[model samples]
Target: MLDQAWFSKVGFDWHPHRGFETVTLVVEGQLEHHDNAGGHGVLDPGDLQWVTAGSGVIHAELAYRRRPVQTLQLWVNLPRRKKMSQPRYQNLRAASAPLVEGPGSRVRIFAGDINGVHGPAELHHPVTVAHAHYEEGGSFTHEIPGDHNGFLYVVSGSVLVGPDRMPVENGHTAWFPPGEPGLTGIEVHATQATQLVFYSGLPIREPAFAYGPFVMNDRSGVAKAIEDYQSGKFGPIPTTHR
Candidate 1:
């Protein structure tokens, strides 16, 4: 996950990429996307875009206006079989994602299933991602998968996790290691008005070689990626992609 941790920030000029996936989750104001893959759009709060730069692609993200633009661009590694698949994209808007409310809290599911409900994202891997909002003193409990790697990130508030109600400060990513660990469902309490994002996924226990935007399984794969990129395997960014 990559972020400037600011609601409003500037971005670099357009760039090219390959060998991985980018999931941009907009949490604040607005963001604009332009890419060589014939993609362009403005993302408001709660909007997310998934870009699969399989074989190759070029893309850029920038501020859409003077609005706050806090967004998390997460790169999920691709396995060998999906490393060369055709690039694709899917945008899941805020309204379309499932919203579950409890007392003074609201939880929006972006991917994976919870309470037999699924979010509107399609991806090569199995994972669950969700954003949560809580009023002061609000509390919510969630049933996590038995064997999934799960954790919670405190976006901007104090929170307590697990039965012990471990205190988590802002800007902290509280990781929950796998196994019973005496934790089954997690109960989160907001010491103040708070917001958080939860994640759970099947662990991809493989070696990874990474450079810039490319993430491969080994050194040779990284070298080949560099070669393909220099040789223009990824197309150019169109002037009108924005």
Candidate 2:
């Protein structure tokens, strides 16, 4: 889910996980993430912190300022073969990402190519992420690969997608199914401007078992994870939750 936390401080302390990939993108303010696996850092605007909880790990995220925090956290499905692999993390900074600009639009590539530039966020699966900003009455077209499930989230102003002229307003999301077409057109209508974050990924064919920050293949795995954490298998509790 897309989360908008306004000056919110959460102590959802670290825990263990066996399978899945969590991608957290910071859109505004700052956040600090620490874990027992020797990974700790802070995220600023346009930064992406991805943790692949393959085998298991303990982690935490805390707000570090009084200003509101806006970010997107996505849970990606992992294939069965990679479910038990070793844990990994990627911290991508804003300078590492690529940006494309035109007459009335700006595009930031997070995982795929726009025109010819590509983002620096490494991926275990095929995906594309882009943040687009358009001036009033501006328009652009994004080419979607065949058989790829894609969606566009309007973060500000209003945008029209596809020939049906589907109206996507601020805080609304629009999805494009596979095998439909190769390109999706977007038009912004507002006195000021418009913005959207686009995300597309390969569809997984495996079952998903999710329980509050932990995602596994089945209920048994989830139960085992909970037991392991309670037994202190991950690590000792941190002195500060933040």
Please name the candidate that would achieve the greatest lDDT relative to the true structure: 1
Q: Indicate the TM-score of model 2.
A: 0.86
Per-residue accuracy of model 1 over 1-242 as CA lDDT, tens digit each? 54534545566457766677887888788888877756688888878888888888778787776456787777777777788889888888989999987778899888887555687888787777888999999988866665668878788889888788899978888886667422357788899999888877766777878887788888888788888877777766566532
lDDT of 2: 0.73
TM-score of model 1 (CA atoms): 0.91
TM-score for each of the candidates = 0.91, 0.86
Predict model 1's lDDT versus the native. 0.77
Candidate 2 local lDDT, 139-197, one digit each (tens): 66776565677788877788777776777888889887766545444333333488778
Clash count (model 1, backbone only): 1
